[model samples]
Target chain A: MKSFGVNLLIAVIWLLLSAEPSVIAFAMGFLLGFVLLAVFQRVLGSRDYMRRVFALGRFLLVFAWEFLAANANVVWVVLFRSKESLHPNFITYDVTGLKPFEVLLLSYCISLTPGSTTVQVTDDFRTLVLHTLDADNPSAVRARLDRVLKRSILSFTR
Target chain B: MTMTEMLTGMLVLSGSLLILASAIGVLRLPDVLCRSHAVAKALTLGIFLMLLGLWVYQGEKQTALKILLAIFFQVVTIPVGSHLIGLLALQKDIPRWRHRPIDDYREPGNRS
Candidate 1:
């Protein structure tokens, strides 16, 4: 398969970078090399490697911070609050500006952001339906996610 | 122990604890949809920290780059898988808690 050749090529490159010249290093590189290909098949599509690298850095920093905050928010909700304190509701997200791939990635980002899970994306991909644990301020949630999280994800698609 | 080792240990410990918290969340949360929320968050954070820790410990360019790649893939996949599972829960007519104010599963245009 084509993936196999790509895998081998990465493994060779790995060996070159590490320069350890040991069997263990090569083996690890081969294994990890395959994984990089498998994992980043989408990311690898971009020919603009230089621009993408910077975008990737920004995306990672933003997501990492959001990820940690989401973890904390969910932990608190589950551990400290009783059912009475929780509010679960659905909200539809506007997906007009984003591409198909960006929309798909957006759902994932939304779900991982503590209080929300995307239940459905419309057939046309024009609308995304999300369920939030705390929907007290649906508009605020929508604005923030749209601006800070989902909008940033658009760069990855380009 | 070296500074890198200490940092790696801390990272791994925190990552494991996040995962442990996710497991508890699955049990404590009332419904599958809510549980999905907890699982998605915890899984992303947990795996990322663990991989980052391993990269720090390894201190090799190739291995570290691959680990970073793994984390990116894992993060991207978790939300999607969880989203599908949550969709299934909705399809099954999983009962919502009393606090649930809306059900847009029919169509957002239709409010019940």
Candidate 2:
């Protein structure tokens, strides 16, 4: 978080220095700041910053893919699939050791993805109740959620 | 007339179509949870795509930045909104569809 603040500060400084004051200028500044931080990692204690940034980028790409796939799946179910075949169900997800913010992100990802909407989190924050629009196989759905959303979230956060 | 204009038009059209699909899902789906799925995912993505089309059409850095910001907020907030709504419905004990829904949250004996 400190490194992120420093990076943003550098970007803003660069924006002020540049005459155009455009988004591209700010982005270029950010990129330059990233490189500088990387080069002087020992001084800045930003050893994790570079890896976190890469993980964040990968997570974003995975999220984009999930978002598109979700849209496509919903479109197919809505437009083409018959109503009788639909099987909506609630499934409990174990979130034993995840932090609150991580749980929040995971819930948001699950809610935004195909076939699932997170309905509630238990008081202990160890379990999440998800309402899946179609759960032909409950275990399969759970496994997929763990494999796709949970894994990406852990990679970025931890 | 121009290629950019055509691309923008196509993107906007598809985005609207996806939104339309979401509307259909809300009407055709069996229950509130399913409807929320349509609204949260499809509607959100549709709006994002539409904003993207606008950004592409405008082709201005400032406009693009603003649109990106708008997309960020939309993406972050929409799911939360839907989650709250779903949570409310669950708390209220809203009736679900007739389909067999496996609720693992409930005790094995309590499931209906």
Candidate 3:
């Protein structure tokens, strides 16, 4: 957080120093700040900032792909698929080892993607109750969540 | 129209079509949970693409920045809002669709 704050500070200083106060200028400044931080990591004592930023970038790319796929899935279900085939049901997802924030993020990501919406979390936070639109293959859903969402989230956070 | 303008128009049109599809899903889906799924995912993506089209059309740095911020907040908030609605419906013991066979959360042994 401190490193991020310093990076933002550097970007803002660059923005102020530059003649054109445009978004490109700000972005350029931010990139410059990122490079500087990377170069002076040992001197600055902020080692993990670059790794976190890269993780964040990867997470964003994965999320964007998921978001597009989600929209496409919804469109298919809504337009082409028959209503009777959809077996909407609440399934339990084991969130045994996730931190509270990671669980929250997982639920939000679940809700945002594909056919799942997290309805409730157990008091112990060990399980999440998710309402899936198409439960014809519940195991498939679980596998996809584990492979795409949970993996990306763990990589970004841990 | 220029290439950028053509691209913007196509994006906006597709976004509108997606939003329309979401509305149709809301009407056609069996229950609240299913309907909310449509609203949360499709509608959010539609709005995002539309804003992206607008950002492309404007082609200004400040406008781009503001639209990016708007998109961020929209993506963050919409899911939370829909999740709360789902939670409330569950709390009210709203009936699930007749065909739904599994409800692991409400099973006697599963309640925490």
Candidate 4:
């Protein structure tokens, strides 16, 4: 019930933010949400409100912190680096999180960071290839990612 | 000089410099994946700054919105394009530089 509320709120907010919105668009978006909710209910065997709230709280906290950290990292990179000799590399790291949405969030967060981007998601979503400007310390970032993902999973899945 | 003119001039100069820097980065980066990063971030920022300047000078809300939409589209698409290129590079086994010691992903058996 709460997830449905959250989803409905998201739909309304999206409608409000979009350019030149109309009743028809709102109806279309609502219909789409209904269909999605129906599908979600079928796949997950009903929504668990407690679990969803716990998961959402964890995601919000971690995501906010990661965003701030990424922004700070960007400031540091922009200030110290002189735009030369930046050896960029794409490296693959094995991922160990369940849930497709969590994986998607991780990838999007990586892409949002200034010097790093997510390149590919494996077929099973078990691994991701990431392109980073400072590939020297890729493991550190990967470790941080793992920690964040673990926290997310503990909050929601377990 | 007029305030608008000054702003425009600054915007154009900064935008061009950003573009040049991105191009240089792309050319100088060690690997295909790195180069893609340069193109995705620096190039997009350059273009966005440039468009923002043009929009500011125009001072029309609709035009500004359009420019913003353009930027939005670019931001949304650049990552996808960069990701695709990276996947292709990985498929080809392009080597990435590892100056640090703690890359667990770069273990002995993981040299692909």
lDDT of 1 by residue, A13-55 (tens): 8888885676577788888865676568677642344345456
Least accurate 10 contiguous residues by lDDT in model 4 chain B: B100-109
TM-score (all chains, Cα) for each model: 0.73, 0.90, 0.89, 0.57
Chain B TM-score, model 4, reads 0.77
Candidate with best TM-score: 2
What lDDT tens digits, residue by residue, belong to model 3 across residues A1-158? 78889899999999999997877888998999988999999998778777878888888898889888888998888888777788788887889999999999999989988889998887888888888987767778889999988988887688
Worst 10 residues of 2 chain A by lDDT: A133-142
lDDT of candidate 2 over B1-112, digit per residue (tens): 9988998998899999999999999998888888899999999999988988998998975567788899889878988899999999888878988646464567423433
Candidate 1: residue B73 lDDT (0-100)? 98
DockQ each: 0.46, 0.67, 0.68, 0.27
Higher-scoring candidate on lDDT, 2 or 3:
2
Residue ranges of candidate 4 with Cα displaced over 4 Å: A1-102, A143-158, B1-4, B95-112
Better of 2 and 4 by TM-score: 2
lDDT of 1 by residue, B1-112 (tens): 9899999999999999898888988988887788888888987789889998998998866667788789989978888888898788766877886545454335644533
* Candidate 2 structure, TM-score to reference: 0.90
Q: Write the per-residue lDDT of candidate 3 for residues B1-112, one digit (tens) a residue.
A: 8999998998899889989999999998888998889889998988888989998988886568798899889878888888888988877978878544564445435454
The residue ranges of model 1 lying beyond 4 angstroms of the native Cα positions read A1-56, A155-158, B61-70, B99-112
Cα misplacement distance, residue A93 of candidate 3 (Å): 1.4
Tell me the interface RMSD of model 2, in angstroms: 2.1
Listed per prediction, chain B TM-scores read 0.86, 0.85, 0.86, 0.77
lDDT winner: 2
Return the candidate ranking by DockQ, descending. Answer: 3, 2, 1, 4
Candidate 2 lDDT over residue span A40-127, tens digit each: 9999999898888888898989988998999999999898877788878788888889999999889988987888989998776778
Error of 4 at B10 (Å): 3.4
Error of 4 at B44 (Å): 2.0
